[model samples]
Target: MTRRFLFAPLIAVALFAACRPSPEPGAGGITQVATIDALLAGAYDGTVTLAELRRFGDFGIGTFHALDGEMILLDGVFYKVRGDGSVGEPPQSETTPFASVTHFRADVREELPAGLDLPALEARIDRLLPQANRFCAFRVRGEFRHVRVRSVPAQSKPYRPLVAVTRNQPMFTLQGVRGTLVGFRSPSFVKGVNVPGYHLHFLADDRRSGGHVLEFTAATSTLEADTLHDFLTIRLPAPGAAFEKVDLTPDRSGELEEAEKNPAVRD
Candidate 1:
């Protein structure tokens, strides 16, 4: 009875986002489904289907419905990194509650120096993209000494807040692997609407396993970044939608910071 009661609203939002007009395929700019604040507040139900999301862009990061796992959309395919550290391609019918993607035509290409971890890699890319205000989508492909990632298990009804869910989130460590890091860097102004800084997800070369990126030391990797001047956001457009009811007023920056960074690593 409790499960059915809680699921009613989630169903409403999904129906609305589905009926909303799909964006034209091959569109430019950053298209984000829903907002980060809502996700933090426990808006786990998906508001946008993968098939519709694919029309927006080919490269980006997001989470699955019910916060089932991490998402990596690379090269026109959607890959799921489950909490158990397994990777699999999700069907187009799957939905996403929060995602940010853009057409990935690299405007800058550079070879990253070996031994650069996530922070160092981000700093290097930041130097290349001096226009800090605009959004930048990037992909880094090549060898890595090791990469640490984490993913949350699927949630049931009466969902707890995101920070709470991630408290026991599972983490994985992969060594000497080759894969692509699909990610985005948003301006600080997008605080509640999107992750203000870098948000990335990883997928292995063999398509076996990967998850939300925590830390990594790259070895001779090549990077490509695309600068997007235009921004598009598709919220749950239905009137009186459940996602619309999620209270987003409180500042969840502290919770977000805690959930995103790996505790054991502070480099």
Candidate 2:
């Protein structure tokens, strides 16, 4: 009886193995089934929900303007949307309020008139190339969210906004020095102007060789649009260091002056 039972289990295992299909190979000995989106999504540790994507789309189109809000995630990292209409690094905090707009009407695909083409735009990300030798290459992926336009504000003279990019991810360098956060600003953008081209900001650590935490912050004018039909780029600084936090209250300048006078304060 025991022998018969053992034989029955062995037969079942053999039958299962025989029914399994072999994986097919593709060009260059690499599998071709993985899609660009899948490849992009796989780079992160978490999944990006549809609701979050919609909010991202709203922010991209300038429909969902928030003075202070948390960063949205596509996959696991914080994806920044600047005032000028560009995407930035993933956020470090899930609850931190970063300024953003929520209404965009442009398509973020290649060859789109809005100029936010993902593939083409990604190819233009040159700021980080210099650091490639220092750190391992990681895939940064995202998609555009489609949002309904509610209103459009009157066009103002175009100007550049101060943009800051911060490293929200921690990494250990080959040399073992800790990563430091850096920030920089863009040229400028007009108050109510809409431009055809999109600006972007990339974030990374100082590449010191140790593990370090980085964050991103941008202070720009609130998008003043009633209906949201216009497509605008979420402008961010090009590859640069992170920025220091500034008071967002109406008396921000006064606070800065006070801080400057304090001996403990450092620029």
Candidate 3:
């Protein structure tokens, strides 16, 4: 018997904040609200390092270290250190290394009021584990943000499980890629059975067979006997990359294909 669980439609809400068109230097001499693209370009221009890139999230409100070991507040604005050691708008893109900061913003943000129960959200997601385990293949579609998984099942023992991921989610920002989870296997085997705390780490790629791959990991853990495990993390490669499935055994070079019949469960 097949069991399915679905999540409630996510309601999109907008937050209202005081609008300031220009940057204002605060007491600490930090510029607030820099463009997303400019921040990335500055990092790429050698003013910032990959290590810095990994520290900041999409929100862009955090503290980062400069070359001189001083802590600077990254208020999401482009700034330049002057000859007098003061901060100001660095040279513009045409004159300097970066052209403009990219406009990247999150689709939704909300502050849960104090005393709001967060465990309820976790409970709701735990109920959907069975549904996520049903599919085993996926593809990246239009806009580089849509991920589609095949609805068919594999014909072999120890069925493979797959998950498709879109670029609009937080996982995309963390991994810097647009792809899907492929070649997942459960430690416990029963066709269509949901195994708690079992997951596989695979590479995310556009195609199931060829391209650059990034490590994607997923797992389910039991909160209680009735509550199922929820997905922990999923990663994919940068946009436009392709990936092909390969065998995971000793040879690790053969193409991946669906089995004719399900294989016996592992002990």
> RMSD of each candidate?
9.7, 22.0, 21.9
Considering TM-score, where higher is better, how would the candidates rank from best to worst? 1, 2, 3
Indicate the residue-level lDDT of 218 in model 3. 20
| Alpha-carbon deviation at 213 in model 1, angstroms | 0.7
Model 1 lDDT-worst window of ten: 233-242
**Clash pairs, model 1 backbone:** none
Best by TM-score: 1
Once fitted onto the true fold, the runs of candidate 3 whose alpha carbons sit more than 4 angstroms away are: 1-77, 80-87, 93-102, 112-267
| TM-score for each candidate, following the candidate numbering | 0.89, 0.20, 0.16
User: Residues 110-149, candidate 2, lDDT per residue (tens digit)?
Assistant: 2222323223332332232322211111222221221110
Per-residue alpha-carbon lDDT of candidate 3 for residues 1-267, written as tens digits (9 for 90 to 100): 122222222221112122432232121111122221221212111233323232222111111221111111122333322212233333222122111111122222222222212133223333433444322111111112222111111112222222111111111111233322221222222222222222211122332221111222122111111111222111221233221122222221111111111112211
lDDT of 2 at 160: 12
lDDT of candidates 1 onward, in order = 0.87, 0.24, 0.21
Residues 1-267, candidate 1, lDDT per residue (tens digit)? 999989999999989878987556445588888888889999888878999888888888999999999999899889999989888888999988888877888989999888999889788878999888988999999998999999999999898999999999999999999999998988999998898889888888999889988999998799999888776565463566459789889999988888888777634
How big is the positional error of residue 178 in model 3, measured in Å on the Cα after superposition? Answer: 34
Residue 80, model 3: lDDT of: 29
Error of 1 at 8 (Å): 42
